[model samples]
Target: MTLNLFSQFASPYLLGVPLIFVASISPWLLLPSPANRWMPNRLIAIQTWFSKTFTKQIFSPIGPLGHKWALILTSLMAFLLTINLLGLLPYTFTPTTQLSMNLGMAIPFWLATVLIGFRNQPTASLGHFLPEGTPTPLIPILIIIETISLFIRPMALGVRLTANLTAGHLLIQLISTATLALLFSSPLVSSLTFITLLLLTILEIAVAMIQAYVFILLLSLYLQENT
Candidate 1:
């Protein structure tokens, strides 16, 4: 029996819903257990040592915040990385490649950065929407531009991942389908389609990794800006 790739289910929200919960509650999960309440010092020592060694090796210039950031970023990366890679598996879906899922992740990160910036520097956060050295007459226009640009981040993130993955998937499916059809009708066309599909599959793997890294990199940049 032949498999129907298009018949498979691939809902972005369904895949991303759990990721949202995991990201939201990760900090609490990392807190020390109640049994170790009396040994707070010990826990702190362990965490400090781990942070020093790991942070130094992985994210040198960032220091202690690097450790916390690493944990947060890794969690996000793992979730997205898994979804992106899983799409290559038979009968599985890649939620990270979906616009809804990518936007769901990016929007929260953008909002979190904005909220953090506001909490850290309320007045300055608004000022950030304006160009640094603009004249008074052009400040309003610059602010409008900046505001639109700021809001566009999530949209851009969504479109980038979604379009790349969806396009790749469609290409693969077309090649495979055409190959099978040609194999029964014309051998030469079948061979070419097969080769094309093979190359596209390899390219898609690279695309998956690049998309995941890009997502995490943008998130890190946003966090750093707020900090």
Candidate 2:
């Protein structure tokens, strides 16, 4: 039997049940609960700081209209961050690596923002499709283009996350295989390959965090447009 480069991306199952649920819920349980303290420990403090900073920064641009989204946005950011980093651990599954799951999360939020825009101000929301002072000939074409782009946002979000993670995982798998294959045949080459693998692992960790931030950031931007 041989290892498949793509096999790691396949969703793991036990008996008849999908493990994604377990993978998703397990990370949250690890978070430390807040307790009475003059000052909390660094971990709790950092988490609190990030939550406040993210909430404030994300909601600032959108003004009061977007304040209601703070809870969902912060929770989503935390969830994504935890899930992504956890995947890097040995034998862990990454739910965000699946386009289906990403899109399932994306579409509803994207649709909600669009709905908010339309619900609050129908004229302004539709105005995004066409700018003021456009030539009659280009108006139709531009509107069509904008509409297409509008709908494409959710797909783009899903694919961006999936592609980045999948590519990184594949690359890591290939490099690790190469490193092992070279270990006996060429010690020097194997050492270099192992070093590269180490660097790539660090880079992947950064990517996991960044992709989560980008996911939340883009959602906030969409809400900004609506609000």
User: Could you tell me which 10 consecutive residues in candidate 1 have the lowest summed lDDT?
Assistant: 1-10
Tens-digit per-residue lDDT, 41-72, candidate 1: 77666655654564344454443443467866
Clashing pairs in 1: none
What lDDT is reached at residue 218 by model 1?
76
Candidate 1 wrong stretches, greater than 4 Å: 1-67
Clashing pairs in 2: none
- lDDT assessment of candidate 2: 0.90
- Model 2 lDDT tens row, 1-227: 23566667778899978998888897789777776998899999988989999888778888688899999989899999999999988888888888999999999999999999999888999999999999999998999999999999999999999999988888888898899999999999999999999999999999999999999999999998888
Q: How does candidate 1 fare on TM-score?
A: 0.72
